[model samples]
Target: MLDGTLDGRAWRLNDRYRHHAASEVLRRAVGDPDLGRVALVSSFGAESVVLLHMVSVVAPGLPVLFIDTQMLFAETLDYQRAVTARLGLTDVRVIRAGADRIAARDPDGSLHRVDPDACCDLRKTVPLEQALAGFDAWITGRKRFQGGQRATLDFFEPEPPTRLRVNPLAHWRPQDVQDYMIENNLPRHPLIAKGYPSIGCAPCTSAVAPGEDPRAGRWRGRDKTECGIHFIGGRMSRRKVTA
Candidate 1:
C-alpha cells in the first residue's frame, strides 16, 4: 500500500522518524505495512554488527542482504557467517556477481586495476541493484560522522524515481557505535584489531594507520571513496567511512 511520489513519502517519513531512537526507527521501517518488503543491505564490515544486532532484536527473520563481490577478504567472509550465527539472524542472503558477467567483463580480474569504477559496478553495484529489485526499501548502516559525502545523511532518503533508503544510524557518532557494541556484547569484525578500521574488497582495501581517517585505507592512492553501490542519479554516494 505504499503510495505517493518518492520524494513526498520520503520527506514525510524522514520528518516522522528523524528524532526516534535507532531501535525504534528500525522497528518502524521493518514493521511498516506501507513499505512493502524491506531488506537490510549489509556488508558485514566494521560496526555492521550494530545494525545487524538491532535487526535481530526487532525481527531476526528479516531478510539480510550481503554482497560478496568475489573479492572480499577471507576475514570478512568469516565474519559474515559468524555474525549471522551469533545474532541468530535468519534469511541471510549472499549476493554475488554472476560467473558469466565476470568472464565477459573481467575475465582476467584486472578490471579493478584499470577501472575500479567499472569493476565496482560489475561486482557490487549491479549485483545489489538486481538483488534489491523486488524490495520497496532497504536499510543501510551509514552515519554522518563518516565525513565526505555522508556528513549530511538523514534517516530516510528517497531513491530517485522509486524506492526508499532507511539509515537508522544516520546520526550515531563513532563512540555511539562502539558503546552499542560494548553494551550489547556484539562480536567485532576480525580486521578491526589488525589496523583495518575500514574494510572492503581485498585488492582495493588497505589497512589504515593510527590517527588516520578510518576510510583512508580504502582505495588508497586513488581519489575514489565509494564502491559505486550507494548512488543517486548516476553519481556514487557514501558507504562505511568511519573508524
Candidate 2:
C-alpha cells in the first residue's frame, strides 16, 4: 500500500492504492470534466507504447501531446507517426519549443551543455506549460522503479497545488512493460534495438554501457537527467503547479 507522506501530508489515490487498473483510471478520468480535460504526454521513446496503447484503448480520441524537441532522432519521428496510425489514436498533437525562444535563448543550440536547466525551461518546459494551460491534471508514464525522484510515486497525488496527477503504472516492473507490448503485439521503437534503451533529444542521448542505468544514456556525461518537460510545476521556477 502507498502509505507514505507527500508534502508532509497523506497522499490519496482515489481512496485506494492504484497499482494496477489503467482502464479504471482512464475511464474515471475521462468521464469527469475536470479530469477528462486530461491529456497523455508521450515521448514515443523506448517504452512509451505501453501507456500510449493504454490511452488508445480507453479513449482513442483523447489528446496525446508529443513534444518534438526538434533535436530528436529521425527514427523517433517515424515511430510517432506509425504508432499513432496503428493504434488509431485520433488526437496526437506535436508541440515544440517556440522558435523565437530558441532563437533568442539558444541561438547556437549548446545551451544544454552549459546550462541544462535553463535550456530545458525554454525548450521543453515553457512550451509544455503553455500546451497544458487548460488542463486540470495529466497522466504520466512514470513508474517507481525508475529509481530517482520517483521512488515514491502514487496513483493519484497533487502535482502540487492545482492538479491531481495520475500514475496508473506506478508499481509496474520492466517486465510488465514487456508483457504489455508482447501481449498486444505493439510496435517497438527502432532505436531500442540500436542500444538506446531510453530515448530523448539526440544530442543529449547516446548508447549506454553494459549494466548502466537505463537513463544513463540520456544527458550522458552531463550533470543532468530529466529534460524537465513533465516537471510537476512552474516553467521557470518549479515552485508552483498550474495543473
Give candidate 1's TM-score.
0.94
In model 1, the worst 10-residue window by lDDT is 234-243
How far residue 150's Cα lies from its native spot in candidate 1, in Å, is 1.0
Candidate 1 residue pairs in clash (backbone atoms < 3 Å):
none
Q: What do the candidate models score in CA lDDT, each in turn?
A: 0.88, 0.78
How displaced is residue 229 in candidate 2, in Å? 3.4
* Strongest candidate by TM-score: 1
Q: Please provide, for model 1 over 57-153, each residue's C-alpha lDDT reduced to its tens digit, 9 standing for 90 to 100.
A: 9999999999999899999999999999998998999999889999999999899999999899888888888888888999999999998778998
- Give one digit per residue, the lDDT tens place, for model 2 in 1-243: 544444322144455445447667666766654443688888899989998898888889988889888888999999999999999999998989878879999999998788878877777777777787777677888889998767887766675555656777877798999999999999999998888999988888899878999999988877676777545553444443343
Winning candidate number (lDDT): 1
